[model samples]
Target chain A: MEPVLTALSAGTSVDVLIAALFGSAFGLVFGAIPGLTFTMALALVLPITFALQPTAAIAMLLSTYIGGASGGTVAAILIGVPGTPSSAASVADGHALTRAGKASLTIATATIVSTLGGLFSLVIMLFAVNLLAQVALSFGPAEIFALVIFGMSTICGLAERSMVRGMIGGALGLMAMTIGQDPIDGVPRMTFGSVQLLQGIDLLVAMIGLFAIPQVVETLAGHRAGHQMKIDTSSIKVQLPTLRFLFSYRWNILRSSLLGTIVGAIPGTGGPIAAFLAYSQEKRLAKHPETWGKGDMGGVIAPETANNAVTGGAMIPMLGLGIPGDPATAIILGGFLIHGIQPGPLLFTERPDVIYTVYFLFALSYVLVTILQLLGVRLFVQALRVPHQILALIISVMCVVGSFSIRNSFFDVGAMIVIGFFGYVLQKCRIPLTPILLGLVLGPTMEREFRTAMIMSEGSLSIFSQSPTALVFFGFALLIVAFHVVGSIRSRSAGEARPA
Target chain B: MTTPALRDRWTGLVILLVAIAWIIGSEYVIPSGYSGSAFGPRTFPTGLGILLAILAVVLIAGTFRRRDTLPPPAPSDAVDEPAKVSTRDEMWGAAATFGFLIIYFVAMQVLGFMLATVLLVATFNYFVLGSRSLVTTGAVALGLGVGVWYLMGHLLGVYLPTGMLGLGV
Candidate 1:
């Protein structure tokens, strides 16, 4: 009780509160801008945070990190652009609602669910940090490899036409990841002496190219607005979701929040992966599974909720152990070090004040951003009312700016253009983008872990079975594949039996 | 692709070739010596290449056996299948958009962000939107091009190419 009182009092200072507010708004802009990342947001702000008090400094970092993750939904829902990679899945259903004239409802649902999910993860992280940290550390190289495979199984759920196409997309992404220096060895496999190729294709370039650039082309083709009655979006009220309506999905919120926290705490996984995993789980559990990917409301809520929840979940590892959670949290970890605070097990006992400050700021930041999103929903939806020609023009330019800002290299911008064309072709072919993205994000990690395990076991396969964690995750991967196959067979037979 | 089945078949064959190329590429990987060597670098990519090849075969087989569904519906329309097929205007519209995108990429580097955006937006509205009003098109082009440049360069302190104008921002 003494420690709690002291920490709360310290966290309530004007400097700390003001810093939290500024961080939230600032990070919102960073997240809402397509191609700008949270890590960049943290690094950009670190210079000024040097002089502030320790608690205030840490508060700003936490708020910015939380705000950036939640703010991605605005662009994704309104303009069909993922403002941050974390919200890529949101584009699947949120944009559908936008085209259907239900943009306000979709934004409202996302805000309410995201806040609850974030708060839920914060509570678990605060109370169960110790136990979760142990489980996270136990994941060795083989276990990490198996986990990536289990994540790859999600390509099944994301497959639009069939799983085989999804595998091809996934494999292509993994192959693309092989273009730079090898993760295990320093080997440069696919670089063709351009020097730029040695650093590999930037994930940000690939994401912007795959997700946003295609929309520009579609808008030009008159595909942005579908054949639905145009509703007057300017005057619509952005109502807060009714409690009864939200309470109905209590199980989904709880389950996804838990999954988000677990995955985020595991060190290597980020919000996009968590968001997709949660989406797949919800789709599998839903009564009307067929409606997924066609603008289903659950698809919007599940991914948004899980991604926001990851803010706190990702923080657990960075704070409990010395390990950084995701890229954003890694930058925040740097912020901690700059403020002369070391974050590990000892820091919890030594500086309880700084730890509690992070918790309070996280809770406060989500509430602040959610309220901002709710209040500004009407303005955000105005994006849909803009002319297609103008919107496409703006988006294409922003895509250029986004890719350019990542490394300040002309080569990356050029790569984005080329990838945009590739994405355009794939979209025409109906090959789902999610599986390819999954492979890109997870591929390097998968290769590194697989090789490390093999070398440790002297290229023997028995290493996978020796570790209980590795064995379990591999088993889970096999189960997912088996279930996907069975489900496909049953659906096929049912379709064939119908009278033609 | 005009048809989904035909498209998937092509996609599968292209992927198979890419997988084979990837295996050949793996053999050339030379470690930079900054990191410790574990297993052979080719091991992982080779394994993935084989898996990819198998998946490509499966995708082609499935495409050959599956029924042909109707063309995908446009996002904005309600009618399941409109009588009007892909017309010449839509084809030209798509091509113009692609051309404009490439032009913008080059223009931004050569003419700078602000000027290039203005040029790109002007050309895009005239060609893609087919907007006839010069005043509206000019105003929007200038406004968006200049406005975004100001936000990204001045307000956010993010970089945008200055090109020839040397606008400082």
Candidate 2:
């Protein structure tokens, strides 16, 4: 309680509060753009945070995290572009609701429910942080390895249409991870003697390239040609959800929030999966399931709430265990690392002050972001009308600039372009990019843990078997894989039974 | 013949070759130090290579067996789907954009972000966006370029390259 008070005191300071507002505004603007994403936005701001006090820097980044997490819904609702990857599930029903001439209601419901979900998760974070920290304290290298596998196994559940392509994407990312120095030993692998490869591919550059550059090309090719987003703002009305309307979905919101928090607490899963899972569950349970893709208000609420809940859920592992729940959190973890803070069980014990500061700022960021968003909705909606060609050109140049800014290396720009093309080709083939991002983030960790575990066990593979926590995670991973294989076989037979 | 399945097969073949190359490459690389640890750096890459090869094979084989069906028609509800461009036009647009970006990146160091951005934005405005008014194009380019330059370099204090010309603030 004393730590909380201390942190809260610092959090409410003028400088920290000011930083939070600026970060939230930056995140909202970036996240509301179609090609820009939470990860890219955070990465771009990461260098600037270097100059601030630790608490202020983290508070600002956390604000950006909170804002970016929810801001994606704006683009998803208005244009179906999914401003950030987390908002992907929101697009289907969100855009449908907009077309049905309820754009304002959909947006308002999204904003309100998202804030509620975030607060709900923050409550969970307060209650569960200590227990989670205790659990993390028990993990060994083998357990960590199994945890990574469990995280990787999510690719199976996330795979759409084909698990094979998704797995291939994961493999590609893992291969990319092996490009730099081996984590366990400082020995270089796959560098091909290039000095630049010594530090490995910058994940930030790869992320921007993979997410932004392809969108630029795709926008230039497809969207501007005439397939532009035709949003009729003049006829559209923005109406806030009434008390009755908001109260009606109380049970659904609670269920989605709990589900999202649980998924978020897990090592590998984050917002998109949680949003999709929550949305699909609601869709399945709805009385009129046929209304789901057509313009159901429940559809908007479920994904938005779930994704917002993910903000708190993602922070759980980052703060308690030092493992990032998703790519955005991973980048935030990078921010923590840059401040000379190693986040693990030790963090809670050694820096309870910082932990409480995080908690206070994390909750406050939601309030600040919501206010900013309400005041800027008109401005943001106007952003939707900007020409796609201009957006594409700006994004392309920024991608180059942003990539170069990461290390001030031209080589990074080229790497981003190359990865962008690869991402473009894979996206065209319907291969999911999320798994690849997950793999890249977790691959090095997995390798290091596995090697460390083996060394401890004197080269015996049974170290994985011996650890109870590892066995549990491995069991979870196996169950997911089993589910995928069974699901694949069932779908294949169903296809076979169909009329030729 | 123009089915998505055929296209997938080609992609799978390319992946297969890459995976095989990855495997071969993993074996040949000599690390500077020999480790007494049970698992060396090669373990993960070798495993990933095998996984990639297996998946590629499965994908290619599945393509041969699975019946290729056309995608369902676009939903009438879609308001903002991408417009279709001809392959030739798409290539041209891509080349123009990519070409411009590469030049901008190179010039950013020598001419600084401000001047290079001005040049790129002006050129793109004229050629790519096809803006007819030179005055509007130049003004918009100069404004945006200098605005961002001032924001990043002056306000944010991020150091942009001061190239041979040293056109920086």
CA-based DockQ, model 2: 0.54
Worst 10 residues of 1 chain B by lDDT: B81-90
- Candidate 1 lDDT, tens digit per residue, B1-169? 4576787788888878877877766665444343343457777677788998898888888776666564554656646433232435445545765687678778777787888888778877876567789998999999887777675576546678877557543
> Cα lDDT of model 2 overall?
0.79
Identify the leading candidate in terms of TM-score: 2
lDDT of 2 by residue, B1-169 (tens): 2567888888899999999999888988946346676578788898899999999999998887776664633567344544446666666666766777778877876887877888888888788777778997888788877766675567556566666687664
True contacts kept of 1: 0.54
Complex DockQ per candidate: 0.38, 0.54
Q: Classify candidate 2 by CAPRI docking class.
A: medium
CA shift of A222, model 2, Å:
2.7
